[model samples]
Target: MSPAVPIPEDVREEVLSLAREGVPRNEITRRTGVSTASVSRICGGPDGVSFDRSATAAAVQARVVDLKAARIGLAASVLDDVQLARQRMHGAEDNRAFLDGAKAVAALAGTHVRLVAVDKDDSSDTEAAKSMLGKLAQALGVAAGEDADQAEDGGVA
Candidate 1:
């Protein structure tokens, strides 16, 4: 007969699923009733495992979907707070109060908003990126190039 499998496939798969789902390693240990050593082995040795090379890659992918959904829910909940901050910013009784509220709003927005700059140096594209960017910015009600920096820097645009 073949030598006994160190960790049964089903058990290993279960351990991987729990780890990818954001469960703490200790909790996974308790839940799976597997020894700490086994958990460590399955999750990759001491340094931890890379998702690409790990056996639990599929489970990790599933967890990514869950993480994205949680992020959407959190962003949605923050909408109400954002609206309130706007109101507070508008209704400040003094300059200091207004500045406080404005700062809060700006800081909060900074956390959730991301600016991505995609530079495509590929010469194969026929159209110039600068012109395309300009059009896109205008259509989106934003300033282009230098004007964009001015707007973001609080200058009248």
Candidate 2:
């Protein structure tokens, strides 16, 4: 939708009214009895979808910030009534609610996780090393030790 293209005054007004309210183009077209072409023109061509960094981009970037802010606010509010937020032994439901709220607080306040990368493990060398160690230990009359006490498990001294 290219807003740059001129629409008829009536169509332009109608489009703006519906658009400001977040109405879908199809709905706008249906309601206004206007063609999709007219709606697209009033919307600023789809090809020229310009998101001003300070506006649209900022809004997208701050979405998480907004969500965290809301979450923190709600988490705080959940405790305003001290009685409800208080923990009582044998109160599984209340405890669960409190723990859930605490988790939300932790999430909003903590350093969240991020995945770095994933690579395949080449275990041929590790297996070969382990086999050599077991053979050497057996030849030396030393206990190769339990399966859990292997090099890969960091259990070998």
Candidate 3:
């Protein structure tokens, strides 16, 4: 068996300092010639250190859930605004502009909905956003469907 390596007091302090400075444990091990496992033990291990990986991960997951919920709420609100805009454009001559704005709002709402779905499914937020955006764009093409030609030329009834 290899002899156990002792981390000197000064080296320990340096490692702790580097950890506090946001250097990763692996990097600290490389710089200090300490074993990666030892460095982790000294800086974040159960008995020697205060860092709690499980707690940190739980907190991050909670935050993500909160953010995703907020995104969904914002999307719903925008969709409501779009509906109101459509209602207000009734009997108005500028139906085209109003309908265009409503379409934009719907697109944004669809994006947020997809984002929330992604979060619910445990996908990365960035990836979810991109996927949702693509889906929203495609969905928008069929948004008006059979009403398209009529809505474009005819004012809201």
Quantify all predictions' global Cα lDDT against the true fold. 0.71, 0.59, 0.73
Q: How do the candidates rank by lDDT, highest first?
A: 3, 1, 2
In candidate 3, what are the lDDT values of residues 1-157, reduced to their tens digit? 9998688989988888888777766778889988888787887654354433576689999998898778777777766765766566563468687677667667766765675566464557669889999999888877666467667878552
Error of 3 at 77 (Å): 1.1
> What TM-score does model 2 achieve against the real structure?
0.25
Candidate 3 stretches greater than 4 Å from native: 1-51, 98-102, 105-109, 120-157
**Between which residue pairs do clashes occur in model 1?**
none
Q: What is the lDDT of candidate 3?
A: 0.73
Which residue runs of candidate 1 sit more than 4 Å off their true CA positions?
1-55, 115-131, 134-157
lDDT of 3 at 8: 96
Residue-pair clash count for candidate 2:
6
Worst-scoring 10-residue span by lDDT in model 1: 113-122
lDDT of 3 at 77: 78
